[model samples]
Target: MNRLLCGLAANPALPPELVDRLIALAATPPGPSDLPDPAGLSADYLADLLVRNLSERADLGPAQVAALAALDEDTPAQLAHSGHLGAGDVDPAVWPLAALALLDEGRGLPEWARRFAADPDPSLRQRLASCAGLPADVEDTLAADADPEVTAELAWSTTSAPVAARLARHPHAEVRQSVAGNEAVPPASLAALLTGHGLPPARSCLVCDGREIPFAHDPSFQDVDRDLPAGAGCDGTHGSTVHGTWARALSNPAAPPEAVAGFAGHPSVWLRLAVAEHPGLPAEVYARLAGDPAPRVRAAVARNPGTGPEVSRVLAADPEVDVRRAVAHHPRVPFDVLGQLTPTTRLGPHPLPPISAATPEELARGAASGNGRVRMLVAHRHDLPPELRDRLAADPDASVAKAVAPHPGLSPERLRAMVALHGQQVLARVAANPDAPGDLLAELARHEPSARRALREIASHPNATAEALLPCLADGKSRVRAAAHPALPAAVVVGLLADPDPEVVEAAAGNPSLPPAVMAQLLP
Candidate 1:
């Protein structure tokens, strides 16, 4: 069996599935053994397994791990389990706190959290910060905790007012987001968030001029119109551009009513569009833009989030195709309005960004989106549960298969299946990746001679041609041919002069490496 599988078997804590794989590995005919040792399995098989699986014998009474190092696996169960960690010099990977947290699951949470909170490991402290509902002092301690992640959590918990009040200025952007989201940020602290330029608390419902809404990106790049190319700056005449740019800058959802009112009538349609589409704009602004002379302005109003479901009902009824289309896709449009607009095909000519994964249901629905890029995106989601990955594997689009091919999450059998079904072009991508295992390289070479040729080309040097003819002199595949002789190794060329293949005979005859005797063999 391979060293890695053996290593897993040696490790006591390893899952049973891994052990089963290890047993199968031992059964493979050991390769020529000439293969260079892989980094992940640098240790020889048996020793690696013993080290990784961790013999329980060491866990017994080893207050002194150095002494226990000599012990064998059959020592005892409690000794094995306890010795695994308390052995003192155990690998730091065995995070004591994460283990402590797991044990705390069925018991009093606060006590366990507090216990680990005081642990020396900074990483452990950081994890406990997410435990929430701690005493106020514990929250305060974590709020100012040196770790950015810990401090961010303290700022995020609503139960801890003290931590929130102080977290507004935390250097970490995520910490600031937690403080910004806290409703109790005593008005005085609001300016701090404004000055922070909305760093980490990236998502929110607030869309006022100075308030940063969470989850909003600079939508200036979305393709709202197919006729207009992305990033095409308007000649002061483009109302949609001006309005989108302006409305997105609102920090508060409900503006200082006056600043909100004047923007609706700005001379530029762009400015009017901005006011119309503002997520926070009051109904009065929507009423003004709904009747706007510029049809584009009305379209922006239909798409604006600040417009309520009651108002959307009226706008979806508009005669303009663009306006009705905009209303159909707006995130805030209630499902009932969506149903009314269903018969319309106004999904703008430009493709929309992949939809936000707002719900498990949305994610499930996304798997069915007809767009190739959208399907590709879903196929590669790291969080894609196993069943979905299989669906992606089965997707007819080679492009989607290519997207999913590199994920380590795929089982070896699945990867082999992909290589088999998808063809040589897919194998080239896998081979070119630095992280791909050499065994896979060998496997692909064994499967398709063309893949080896491609890989040989990729591995060749500047002096070598793209055909990768150099390695062929020694390649087991006699099809590699003598003329496939690489640029160097003068002695091989001398020997090749008598080759039966004319191409080999000709190439070797021309080589300066051939000695007089070998040169004589090439002549009449």
Candidate 2:
């Protein structure tokens, strides 16, 4: 009997009404069986299996999802784990359970987050605050939340610059301090905190638990705090740890050059070190720090963008090997001086200086250099002259070829030649290029087995045609991208709605090609 039911459920020709009846039968408990069969098949197990199979169907809509959730205590969670449930799918009665399941698994969608943000329960709102990649409006609503803890949590985890700025002035000291410590906090806010100007005054010491005693009297006081002036603390010395805030602010990449320069002469070596590492430090300050006794500070200056040729030349010959190596990597370091330094140091993947900063002569010199690293560095520049670009594309070094393959200026003919010569090595780069022609991407998509990365890139490429994306749907590695591709046909997108991979299903459901009626059914 169970086998017959399974067979009927698997039949695509079965009508919706019959499928509904099958679902009802699966949800019902079986009566006692008098005779034992040769093959053991329990009704309860069959019911669970039927529900799983039904839930995996691409055509399972809101009504069906709601019905499935009502089948058993575990069904809501099972459906939630399937990643097919949208905001409007789960019955309101089962929403709390389904939401908790989704949030616990870190799979909560934007629609759910917007709904949860307005939820009266602080616990729910607090949980939502901790989630990363929140929508902009949701972030704004949470930023203004009455609960200090919610606002504080948002401040800590948010990568949004505007959100960080708003939270930097939060009424609660805890929230403000969290914003200060946040790496994304704007430079103006950090500088204000360092100068003891932006934060509101509080009666209690934030650093030492509101202690009234002088900072000097605190047993925990380190030499670092000795130089911090009175009242520099969040409110006063009593309310915040001035040095701690200063250090965090100064270390921020956005810290203002003028504000950082203020600390260039400070007593704290830590503060001085932070100042040295700042990329926008004034040239005069860079020169001054280059002569400092501390090797680490000088080394930092050597790597700083503001370090002029004069300072770089001095640092190039420094006794400290690290300082010399830093000078070798500095973009501002003269080409002649860069050649003199040791090539043994491994080049980091850090982005080279902007292309606008390089003169044509400098770029040509880098391209003509015997070192592949120099050629590779030159290849990263987007505005390379045609001759230089072709030269780098044909370079013997595979890395150099790979680097130049993504240049938008590369003609389709050149790109095809590179792929034929370098084969799979350069396919991903060519696929990733925004200017890669649709015809080329379509051709590259044919070699899917060997070009997995290229397929993934092609799936997301604006130039990718329906032809390029069709084959990617069968590949698990690129399924998510293919499901999200704008070029994917509505029929294909609908099929992906039942993808075994939860992320792929979610991507397919979100695809723009999915009908408005279908999207309306999916939305809360």
Q: How does residue 226 of candidate 1 score in lDDT?
A: 27
Tens digits of per-residue lDDT for model 1 on 177-276?
4555455554445444543344344221112212332222244645332233344333222323323323433333423444545667777675576567
In order of appearance, the predictions have TM-scores of: 0.32, 0.53
lDDT of 2 at 168: 72
Model 1 scores a C-alpha lDDT of: 0.50
Off by over 4 Å in 2: 1-203, 207-240, 248-270, 278-299, 310-331, 337-342, 345-351, 354-356, 474-477, 515-524
Model 1 Cα RMSD, 1 decimal: 19.0
lDDT of predicted model 2: 0.72
lDDT of 2 by residue, 1-524 (tens): 25334434443444566557767776677656622223475666656666776666566667777787777767776688777774455543346657745765667666878888898888778877877778899999999998777887898789998899888766666576667678888888877777767666533333443434553343444434233344444324444444655666777778788888889888788878888888887789998888888888888898888788999988988888888878866766777675566364544433355333679988898889988877776787777888998988888787788888888778888888888888888889889888888888989999635678888899899999999898777678788888877788888877776666655765676576765455434322
- Judging by TM-score against the true structure, name the best candidate: 2
